[model samples]
Target: MRIDAHHHVWQIARGDYGWRTPQLAPIYRDFGVEDLAPLLAAAGIGGTILVQAAPSEAETDFLLQVAAASETIRGVVGWTDFDAPDAAARIDELAEQPLLVGLRPMVQDLADDDWLLRPHLAAPLAAMARHGLVFDALVLPRHLPRLIRLCRRHPELAVVLDHCAKPPLKGGDLSSWRADIAELAQSPNVVCKISGLATEAAPGWTVADLRRAVDHVRDCYGAARLLWGSDWPVVNLAGDYALWFAAADALFADLADAERAAVFGGNAARVYLRRRGRGGSRR
Candidate 1:
């Protein structure tokens, strides 16, 4: 199955999405499975991993409900208060829902870049590892070193680095981003997503504008460790789904078909759908 490994669906009135303001008018409206299914079909994508856009467990529950009712949503990356005292119990509860595959804390939005490394997070993180849940690192270039440390601390936890740490393609030198990403990739348990690059680039970006970062990530993580995601609706701010998908295809043109398949689908199935400790398919 060809998979778009990352994307989001939301209702505007949910009110938990504090970041979704009028400024992001292009994507500030509601987006649901009905809105995305046609685009997925148009791109020949068979399924998708629905990701959370808000920080509350309420939104996670909302997403789980959506996944339960949708055939195309294979898994969900939800959010929860990792620092909550009952975090482990909460994860255990969420894990009971088969579609819950991962968790993201919106690290990039926090004032403290090092917030994820807090000692309190250890227990919740351990629970995630115990359940075979993925740690979706929604971070920036500056967070890579800390992320590397986290990966070391929880070697068993599957970490998916979102958008190649949101490379600094829009501004400053990429030397720092490149070096840190290379180090992060050395952790075999971590995987990287080639998503959201278009929005990180200067507006009206072409395939060439993103090639350097894409090539660097491919070289560091290899095709097998890289998963392709559209980050749709969000992608609409830079370009539509077809535009980003086409650019991704062009950039990956030299890869063998099997390698492409892994990035587009196979890797996601292996990482998100197969539960650990539980010993069964999440599907």
Candidate 2:
């Protein structure tokens, strides 16, 4: 099945999404599976990995509930307080949800560039590694180095890097970002997602504008390690679902059919849903 490896469902009334303020008027309201269903159908997508938008365990539970009722939601990447004293137990409990395939910490919004390296995170991360869960990294360029270090620290952890570390497409100079991405890709356990780039680029970005970054990532991670995602409503901030999907399709036109399939669905299945038993780390 062709899976949208990354996308989100949120309810404004949930009140946990502090980032969902009045200023971001485009997606300021609730968006559920019903809202995204048609878009997925039009794109010929069979399933999706429903990702978390808020930092609360309530939101994570909310996402798992949504996935439980939906046929198209193949998996869910939820969130929890990674530093909580009982984080390992919390992870064990969340892993009990059959549809819950992964967890994310929303690392991009944090003030500290090295937050992933904190000593307290060790047990929680190790717990996640123990479960057959994927670690969905929501990070930016500055966090890549620390992320690389974290990957080394937990070599058994199955990690999927969200948005190719969300490169600064708005910034013309990507030399540093490129270097970091290349270095991070060296870790065998790390996989990269080709999602959220449109939101990171200048408004009205086209295939040409995204080509260089996409090409660079393709070169570094190759098709086997790369996964495609819509980034959906957040994608609406720059362009709509069809636009980003078509753009990604066009950008990867040169790849072989099998390779393209890997990016769109196969890789995601392998990373997030393949071995869903205890200690299901991909590497």
**Best TM-score among the predictions, by candidate number:** 1
lDDT of each: 0.91, 0.89
lDDT (Cα, tens digit) per residue for candidate 1, span 1-283: 8889999999988899999899998999999999998999999998889999899999999999998898888889999998788998999888878789999999999999899789989999999998889999999999999999999999989999998898878766999999999999899999999999999999999999999999999999898899999998899999899999999999999999999999889898888877743222335
lDDT accuracy of residue 60 in candidate 1: 95
Residue lDDT tens for model 2, 39-125: 999999988999998889999889888888887888899999987899989998987888888999999988888889999999888
Worst 10 residues of 1 by lDDT: 274-283
Q: Which stretches of candidate 2 lie over 4 Å from their true place?
A: 277-283
lDDT of 2 at 66: 88
